[model samples]
Target: MSETFDVIVVGSGAAGMTAALRARDLGLQVLVVEKAHKYGGTSATSGGVAWIPNHGLGGSTDTREETLTYLDAVIKEPVNRERLEAYVDTGREMLGWLGGEGINMISMPWPDYFAELPGSRTDRSLVMPPWDGRQLGDKFPLVREQYPRFKLFNRYSMNLEETFTIAARAPGWKKKVATVIGRYWKDRSTRKMTKRDRLYVSGAALIGPLLARLDHKGVKIRLETKLETLITTGDKITGVTVSHLGRIYDIEARHAVVLCAGGFEWNQELRDRFYPVRTSIWWTSTPQGANTGDALIAAEKIGAATEHTAEGWWAPTMILPNRSASNFEEVHQAVFDVGRPYSVCVNRNGDRFVNEACSYDRFGAAMASDQLATGANTPCWLVFDAVFRQKFTAGGILPSAIMSDRSIPMDWWDHYIFKADSVAELARKIDLDPAKLEDVTRRMTEYAAKGEDPEFGRGSTIYDKTFGDPTCQPNPALGAICKAPFYAVQIHLGDLGTKGGLKADHKARVVDGSGNPIPGLYAAGNATGSPFGLNYPGAGGTIGPAMVFGYIAANDIASRATNRDVASAREPVAT
Candidate 1:
């Protein structure tokens, strides 16, 4: 006989774990099944910023329509306004709910994706409070492994302690490298320092706080438990088959099944089968354990309709050696933060691409054009002077630190960051038109001297400056390439995960291929086709929606089961 609960959640990514937490809160017995060895999933490996629209949280100016405009610019299809609105509606409400349950939110008012438009406002972006390592107890190892080895800080008060400690000692560029990581490592609320500590806040902060909340409630989190199949009868889902460590088991959810298994970005065959382009490499910044499209597939096998498969959570990336996504946090910071001499970014042809320092989307857009107009997939090249390369850290390009945390593993760059003495020689090593390389250098130098980008126009947008260092002299994008012993590395187009999958109604119930709801089944996070269409409004936006819908699915399931919505409740899919 199979065990059962009120709800069965597959995959413990942010959405899955969050759904389980919310379900338990609604008084539903919940079982969270994860295929990975740990909790966190892709969320563990991501920057923790949740791009949000206007929350009643003080200063956020983000609105529903501006968000839609942001989405339309990058996507290739129709935006499902009805379903998408539900996501927005829940975002503000649930965010407050989670905060009430001990999740900490810091208002930045700044646009996460760095939009400078009229509607763009700061402080609306919610940042999870930094969690104390002492609170995590046994989960500290899980937290450490989840984030790249970073320095610890006051988990709750992001500013009070961290900012004062830094400003008191490491003023100016003397600030620690970790402090330069954007919101990934710092606390944002206390307003302790005059200058914003660029410390980052990613899975460490986002997942950390949520995990802490779930811990407080004693949620049973099982790892290495892969959900195998959905038991259905007469169109209703009754239970799920699960396998762990060679053992098979069944767990029936009396109320519902919430599929939060992340998208199938790591599945090579799936990537090739569904993606528009055919390429050998796919280096999305997703967590290493992100191979669970099972939620989407299982639902589909049972006849769920879908949308948004044409695109994904994508960005431009540097193709480093040993073939991995470039350390973007490092890449962006190096070009803009380290105060290194200006550099120029170019493609394999040695010609310039998008604003080298702009957000990954613009970079991806230019590469997409190159792929469609010219058959180019491997967009490589990073031209830096000796000063820039010496001081700057370009994400995965630089080796990770070993002991004292000052340096990276030697193997990191040995695999990528092709090195040569001169522009012509470097072009030879990367294999591109030599004349084109030199000509690009000549033009870039001229542009840097004049301080303007004639091509893609890098520093033109306010969004461009959001990630750029205010210290650069010439336009951040127009820095001259005059420094000697210049180096260029190859970059690639990467997707965090496919945004396409099973289409679901606002309640997160899977809709059939015929556009009918599949009872007793629901999905959130990437497992369901994105409600955002191709539009990604901000950084944590994907995660924020996932968490919100996860909460909704849980309560809705419990509501129906308890007869709270007696009149509207339909019979379970499988009797």
Candidate 2:
């Protein structure tokens, strides 16, 4: 006999889980299925920040008009205005309701990615408070582990605040590090079970609480369950055909089926077909072998339309050589560090292109454009001097004060940061013309001394200076790169995830090619066409809309759904 659910949510990330939880709260029986062995998907590995404008939290003074103006200014592609409006209004409600459900979030003063825009603000991003992983008991092992870059020494994890504090070596940073290590050591009980710490931060923090809440609400999440196809009755998506432990079964959704199975960033065929440029999956920071467009493919087979297939949440990334597994390689996101003092990203021609201190998405877009135009900027070099290395981290290496130049493993020299005694030698090692490289370096040093960037306006915005060194004389973001022992690390255009997939409406209903919502079908997160289009509004831009729309989808279904059970119209085609 087949099982029945009020709602069947595919994928177990924030969007799927939030949809299930919200549906359950509306008195619906929900079943969450995950393709991977663990829950949380990419959300568990992300920074776990949600950007909610006018949230009225942490004294945010954002307004609806301001947010709308800002989105209009920043988002260039065509978007459903209703979805944008719904996000601003419903996002606040989601935050408050989640808090009431015990998912405590603190407002982060992280400025919008486009700080110069009219509607941009500094107080809208929210992050979950760090929680104890031990609270989840044996289920702790079921959650996906955070990326190594988010942890110190690949062991103890730190929240965003602590990460910034220690990275900048700010006041009391020593005490903070000591306290973190101390806490990890004190958790002898957890230590006995596993080397993983008791403290859960970032995406883990948010996911941990959500899992607990789902368990309390009696939500059943089937791990290692793969959705083979959406079982539809006419135009209505009635349920799903899923395979588990080599057994195939039909689970009927009495009301609706929500697809939140994430983007196709990992699928090479999809990337070659849809992505604009830089089609290498190795350049991405998302989880490997996951988010392979399962839901997108299944829905498209059922007549769902896709948009923004060429866009992604662009970011600059460096592929590290130190850590290598059988199939996986370490990728360090150069989001903030490249914006700090004494560094510039240059093409093979040794010319400074975009402002090194611009928002990462913009930086990535610049790289993509430059590469497409010139064909020499795809694999760029982030050039810096010894002084810069001493003050800030580059690639995946820590600051010299902590990791030191001499103590660095010998094998990492060329692969990680190509070290040379002078700018000319560094240029020669990286296959750039020595004279042009030196000329660019000299001009950049002059800009640093003048406290201005006439070429690219490097140190001009609040967004630029957010990760800069305040103690640097004059412009905190500008500093001389004239010191000897120069270093350059290769950077690639990377992304948090692909931002394109199945198109959906303001109410989270998946729309067909003719722009009509498919009955009993819904979608959200990276799996759907991003409501914000190619523009990233602020920190947590990717995950924020995902959670909000997931919440909206559940509510929309609850409002219109009836308790009529539909029999399967036809046999589901087995894959």
lDDT per residue as tens, model 1, 1-575: 45777788887777887798777777666678888786687776665566656566664566767655555554456766677778766777887777777775776544445464444455555666555443565664454233232233213123323532332232353354355344443445423432222222456667766776666665666888887888886778888988999999888878788889888777766677776665433466566545647777777778887777755676645443332433533321122221123566666556665666565654555566666666654454566665455544454444222212234345553345555677777777778787888788787678767767687566666656544434455665456666677666556666666677778888888888777888899998888787767656566766777887888888688778763332222221111
Prediction 1 TM-score vs. true? 0.82
| Per-residue lDDT value at 393 in model 2 | 83
lDDT of 2 by residue, 1-575 (tens): 26988899999898998998888777777899999998798999999998888788866778888888888899988888898899888988998888878887888878898888898889888889898877888788889989766787779989889999888777888998998788888888888899887788898888899988888777889999998988889889999999999999999998899998899988888988986675588888888889888999999999999988886788888877645442445778888777778888898888778988888888888888888888888789999998888878886777898788887767777866799999999998999999999989888889889999998998888888877888886888888889988999988888889888999989999999999999989998999988888878888988899999999999998888665222221111121
How accurate locally is residue 278 in candidate 1, as Cα lDDT from 0 to 100? 56
Could you tell me how far off, in angstroms, the CA of residue 116 lies in candidate 2 after the best superposition?
0.9
Clashing pairs in 2: none
Error of 1 at 509 (Å): 1.4
TM-score of each: 0.82, 0.96
Predicted structure with the largest TM-score when compared to the true one: 2
Alpha-carbon lDDT of model 2: 0.85
Counting clashing residue pairs in each candidate, in order, gives: 45, 0
